[model samples]
Target chain A: MMHPSAGGVLKPACYAKPLLRPFGLAWIVMMSVAATTQAAPEALAQVDPPTADHSQFEPLQQDFASGREVTRACLECHTEAGKQVRASIHWRWEYRHPQTGQLLGKQHVVNSFCNNVTTNLGRCTACHAGYGWDGPDFDFSDDSRVDCLVCHDTTGTYEKAPKRGGRVLQEPVKVHGHPLQPPDLGKVARNVGPTSSETCGSCHFFGGGGNGSKHGDLDTSLLDPPPALDVHMSDAGAGLECSDCHVERAHQIAGSRYQVTARDRKGTGAPGQRRYAATCASCHGIEPHPLGSDPAALYQGAKLNAHVDRIACQTCHIPAMARGGVATKTWWDWSKAGRLDADGNPVKRHDADGNLTYWTRWGEIEWGEDLEPDYRWFDGTMRYTLPDQTIDPSAPVPINRFAGHHGDPAARIWPFKMMRGKQPYDPVKDRLVYMQLFGKTEQAYWQGLEWQPAIASAMEAAGLPFSGEVSFTETRMAWPITHMVAPAEDALACGECHARDGRMAELTGFYLPGRDSDPALDRWAQLALAAALLAIGLHIGLRILFHRRRRHTE
Target chain B: MTRTVVMFTGLERLWHWSQALLIILLLMTGFEVHGSYSLLGFGTAATLHVLAALALIVVWIFAIFWHLATGEWRQYRPTTRGLAAVVRFYLYGMFRGESHPFNPRPKRKHNPLQAASYLLFGVVISPLLWITGLLYLGIDLWSAPADLPLAPIALIHVAAAYGAALFLLVHGYMITTGRTPTAHLKTMITGREEIEEASQREQQPERG
Candidate 1:
């Protein structure tokens, strides 16, 4: 309870003097007894306050000497490096006791994963080292595992490990781990611009937990370069590095909430709140579009409008020339059923069924033919016949069945032989009448085969009796099937389907290929002006009424 | 007959109207910029915001010169006497229709509260906005230096913006503290205001 500033609240003279010593000792003992009694009237036993389970705490291993040793070792080559390390957060990774919020320093007794009373040797030292004492488990004397190069590079190359192995032979591994290596000192230390889709995807692509923890599927294969994803990086062809957007990597690694300062290229500090765009605009330019124009408009009106309409610009245009490519969501069947074919190629097709087919090739799909059926009605029912006799009924067929009838089966039946009442009836007329009326034949006497009633029975069951064979005219669908107009809910104008900017508005929302139109942004301008005026008028009217009433009263 | 005519010069009135209009525009645009309301129709709103800001800067330049030449800057000089009184009057007394301690005149138009508010608007809020805006405008020209940190600058910009927003809220509330609460606002519009009776005016002469 004595303050640090007070020299000596407890005097040695009082305790050492023979005459007063006894009285002082007795007084001290009496006071102690009284204080103890007052402190806890019910105290029959003493209990230690619960500390962090520090059975893991131990003497510093030989590997981790004092920070002084590490500093000295680092100073042997680079003296200022220790200062930088001191400013880093890794030096202070200890946690406070959860219950009391007390700094549980190295002396705290705790258990290790091994449940031993010895100092925490393995688990704690992995990240935190150089401390003389640790939890009961670690030995402070062990210096073999203390890696100085985890952050510091003494070799002047940023490589974590030496790349000595060649294509033909592997080099002998060194006993001592390789030293730290800094990047090329001569090269300008440019920040990696904002983290791009490629950078994010390098860690988050298809095989990387598709949409597992990330907000969206970062698989470059599945999605176009989304606008939210580094659009500027893709469009401008600026070589942006990860460190540019993820600024202050040495100070604040990703995922930590620690804040850090950023400077524009010229060192003028960023304006307003430190937001995502504040760091992003350092290289990508302040205004996203030219002259603060609408980005969507510029993209739609560009010479590459077809390309832009088909795919987002960012998908292909990356921050750097090397990074540019059509980004797609790598279709990882999270099911993880073997993705590759027998030859270790990505299985392009599940089977010939086309139902569950996925093509590995990028870009547009080439559509071949539109062998869709065009049925014509000759009687009550519709039908179309294929010319190929080898076509199997069970095999899946791409049939675009239009709603119309084929010729009546009563019109044609081949090789009629049956006679009705022996009047030498015309075989063609009788055969045609029988085939058309009944949609069946007793004559399959041709081709040396007997007549079958299966087809007729099947048609009757399906409520569509085959009337007659109607010929179909074939046509081929074009490559790069750009437009597939199916019946949608509402009749969309050309504008609705296309972008509603300058060019589209000028074209009056019509989808005429290769024609450019200017959009009507003035419509929005008029609306804004009217709204602003209305607000001002309301504000002014209120002011006037209030003032007029006040004057009359005065 | 001592007419209060020509008290606020034409340029002063122009500055006042334009400044108010620009502030409103800036606020609206700023809110939209922050993704608050889609009022100005995003793109055009942004365009108008820059235009109005340029207009405001021009108006501010002229107003600064006018104030310097006419020595009308004294209107915003803050004083301690009746400072607490003016604050208290606005805080509680005005609600009960209490007579103000600082009355408006040609010589001393603004009360202590008004002067303090104007000082904050002119010195702190306006400058902070202007500096930040200029920084934003010239971001390309003045690149962020490698050694210099951006966090502090961003913090200052955001902090100043919030401070201006707070000032605006207080200014709006004080606007309602006039005789019928709109007396001061009327004068800003019509460039004319009716004076209090001579007896009332004499009772509450300008405080130091």
Candidate 2:
């Protein structure tokens, strides 16, 4: 089948033609015969053929014109960008602000390219103008200043239409003030893979206080061999992004809501919440603190290690909701209330000299006797005894010091009998004296086991008639105050009772009656005064120093 | 009979030039990433390195499709007898300046050594670099579970990077071992090489 041409040239077309001879000849003959046969027939027959509507189709030229119009509409929305001029830090290139009393060219506030002007300069117009601005003078007052091509160029041509065409057909309005750039759009779309991070770093790493502009200290290179900073990027296997830690600044300007929130709540929350969107808790959880407990307990216990037991997990690790107003103190203020009585009721009593008395009881008798007949005291001691047991002559004798006045007067008694195997109890023949005083009445008498005036007085104070045989075992003086008690008297009034050789003289040496009278309030007042004086002094000194420095500099 | 031209198009030359430049750049930058060399001075090196790597990726995507559609992939298929002869020629005969056993043709352009190297580079080395580089990029985006260790992944990435560097050094040396000792280099630059008629049609058997 191969046809040999001159100079060893084999004809490919001629070789293939021979293979198709049978089919080709049959096709030609059938076509000729069918044409002649059909020519004389169907002269009298009428038929209707179907047709399609073409009204809906638009010309390609119309579509192209509309696309151009869409671009113009975008420019209209972003007017400042249309003039090809912006009021950015790049243009100002200075270090200080004329207004606002702020340093103009400071590293934190200035853009990378322009130290004098803020990042809000117009250089960003080329990259960030979402819509094209259309105005004679490029007035910012006009809303249609955003250019779609600035950020939508997937073909890498800055001013041309996007290579992928659906961009213009989508919502074309400038919904927000500034349109997000390409890197931002990529992130939102999630269309690109890990390489998208490089797009973000292109601008984020440069300008302002970012890594790029600080003397090339910030690396913007993404495709290079793995960099140390790669560990910080989302693609570097660490899953971090520029936006993970930084938020809000757009076109190098830091006046967005993110900046406001970050500055306003500084030092008030956890690291993750303070920096990012508070979404870190979704992954980290309330790690350091216990969960589902009162947050106030945490703040209260923050200073004391023991207090931490009551804190919840979210308190320290995550942002905890304050129980009360944030400014309110978490600690209880004891100065707001007076001392409580035996049943935790508020005490309201006065002595004969009209001095307020505060007291609580253990069981029956009053413990803190005021030495005034009308004053009531509640004692907090219980008394018990083992009877028929004698004390050795050498051992010290035990006594019920405040039997009738402070505690249950009718003390419980149990008889003691010497067992054969137990130790022997030899009774010593010695005179025993029991003193029972209730409300300044002293009753002391000694009898073998018979009725004694002291015992009778105790029974009477205890509200029991003297009928049973009584023997003493052990008696204790009861003082029921567990927590510190605050008296109603002010610091000045304390001297009336606490003077030398006065009613408080017996307890003065060890007690320092005046000090104990209102310790907490007095200490608090002294501290407050000292703090105020120190603060005033510091303020005055600093002011003087500042004024002197200013004068010297001037 | 189809006549094969010795000259290549400008686009083909551009692609080859860009690909070679990017591969060298990627290798150097990649080595620095492993803390191997101090060249490119870490920060600058890294930036340029990543940029070069990205350019390489773009170039590779286009080059691979071009090679396949143009039927140029046949050049990379390893042929045992052809490859052994090419190897022996380079190891022994090349030293004596003996004539090469195989000649360049449009359908069969690569020598056996070229075929093997290209296969290894395209199929093994390139994919390994890509996977490791991408993994290193997003390590923090999603951390492995607390129980899983990160050392293995890091090891794989680092190992592949070193392997690529080694391959690059060898490839650079091989490019110099052509006819006239600089013929391959010149061909890459001008996209043309002389072919001897006797060696053109001795089709070598397939290699591993």
Candidate 3:
């Protein structure tokens, strides 16, 4: 019942306490003036009063030595929690696509950003939900390995140590010249509650090495986003949590990019009726717009609603991705890696905006903000080009291809963040090469700054034949941009897609008025108009000349 | 001797002006929707274009019923009587200040040439515009074969619109060739015009 800041309101030490939680609440209350004025009691009712405070529990009183030990303590009360977490895609990191029958997920797919997570498990596993996933031999069956605090910690201080197999930093350490203190395990364990946007954003937001670098629509800005940034998540709007739409049941989230639901023909569900699908149509009906008295407004709304059959709501609503301040990585050139200055030390260069544009360990990087996404017709199925798949070196390889055509009934035009990169591939073998980019091994690219040795070692580790020929092959990966939905007023105007050289210019197969025109027909129409004008001009000249002659003769 | 005579009824004048306004509005908005140039935005222009088309339809319905009920539909009946002479008068004699090949009457106002042209407008141009416009506006409601492209339908619609535009330009010029430059314009507004007293007496008994 006590406010966290009530003890020392003016004390400097009180400032050190996490301001993220209480500051988020204060910002929500301040931003939602309309809500407060309309229904103060309803706004207060939504504040989730905690039912059971873990601070009074006997088991959490003792300081925990490791994340596994805390997980052991959590198992005493929530017996099936560990089993549920372990069975999830977050823990297994592997998914066999039902349609394609290809082994996918972080464990298999060769991404354009960091390549594969095989040799880079030590570092990439920092985002893993379990402990000690540094190697492929890690036990997936062990229930105690599930790091419950990562998702449940309400203190906002729990962090998994990077490159240490998902372990918590047991001692104070300096990272990238910034001092970080080890989380007080006892305090975090005692304050455990439901998962928050912060908990999910900790790993998801920081994907592809940094915040807002991977998914253009997701970032730390969403923690307390203004309504203009995202009406669904913002306080003044729906104020929905991540789980509210993701709809996690038994720790298996409902929505995923791997198997997208491009079109929801079922429309809106009944109030309080549970649905497994997480689609815009599931909540807001297929025809979400209201028909009003004004015919023009009604036409606009109706036209927009009818577009749901072939166009996604996000296509117009999320006009631009990475909108709130964080710039997403658009391009990465791994071919430019291993560049060094006159000195032997690793080189790094920052851009005018202080963004790391180049680094010896990675390569040249390009960042983009408030960028319009490339659109394509997607029908829920995505087939990836596996490592063993033969690729044409002459053409840019699509790392993952979205499946659909304009004729497909289920297909709809969806926006995507197209990540382009030039990564190493085995030219002779015609396969994408995986390299060990992390760890202390001599073959590691980060440690040795060499690609040949790194690729050879990784290929050997994965039991793939190395052709000893490395070439930079251009690759493209598409991540669907569906979040950061703007308010209705901010949605794209009709002219955005209905004019010449508009947003759908690249998309072919169907005719769109105001955009598509038959050149021959247009030319003929102009000629006909000119001919009519010529006839009229001649007739007028004759009439005027004849009248003058008659008057003179008279 | 010149005498003023009733050329058009008040309802006829109203119909003519309203139809002209609706056609002009439709043409401007339709071209904008065709991406020619922007005046009102595409959404607004498209909406206005549809509304104007609907207005044109209502006006046409009332005009058609009025023509049929008042037995004035005979005015536009195609007849070869003096048709060739009326064509010749416009082609050569009009430049020489020769007399017109046909005379106007209360019950029969159009010349042979005018009647033939109006017949073409009614049977071909008007039908083309109405059918194509309706099809273009209600395309979504057509649940026909998916392969049926809208390009052909749109092409016909645009072509009909161009035909209407040509008619407008010629009609504007023709009205100036009346007794005076503004004679037809004034008569359309006031529903009356100066005529020869002999021609008035000749046509008066038929008006009864």
The number of the candidate with the highest lDDT is: 3
Scored against the true structure, residue B42 in model 3 reaches a CA lDDT of 82
lDDT of 3 by residue, B1-208 (tens): 6778899989999999999999899989988888878888888888898878888999999999999999889999999998898888878877887656577768788888788777777778888889877877666433334456677877788877888887888788878877677988998899998777665555543210
For residue A373, give model 2's deviation from the true position in Å: 72
Q: Quote the lDDT for A493 in model 2.
A: 27
Q: Give the TM-score of candidate 2.
A: 0.28
Instruction: State iRMS for model 2.
Output: 34.8
**What TM-score quantifies how close candidate 1 is to the native fold?**
0.33
How do the residues A1-554 of candidate 2 rate in per-residue lDDT, one tens digit apiece? 11112112111211221121122223123223322332222211121111322222222113323233434443443344433423333222222433233332221221111211111122332223333221113444322333333333333322211212112223333221434333233222212112123444444343322232222222344323121223223122222333333332222322221111111212113322423222222222222122212333332222222212222111122111111111111111111213455795655553453322322111111112111111112121222111222344344232111121212222111111100111111123232212231122235221111225544553344343443333322222111111000111111121222233332332321222222223343345445546655654564455456547657776
Better of 1 and 2 by DockQ: 1
Candidate number that wins on TM-score, 1 or 2: 1
Model 2: residue A309 alpha-carbon error in angstroms: 28
Residue pairs in candidate 3 whose N, alpha carbon or C atoms collide under 3 angstroms: none
DockQ per candidate: 0.02, 0.00, 0.52
Interface RMSD of 1: 14.6
Model 1, A12-90: lDDT tens digits are 1112111111111232343233323332222111221223322222221123222344334434444444444444433
Q: Which residue runs does candidate 1 get wrong by more than 4 Å?
A: A1-329, A333-554, B1-7, B36-45, B141-151, B197-200, B203-208
- The DockQ leader among the candidates is 3
Model 2 C-alpha lDDT per residue in residues B79-181, reported as the tens digit of each score: 8866778777765555444557667676787778787877887898778878656554334223323223334454555556555655665566567666554
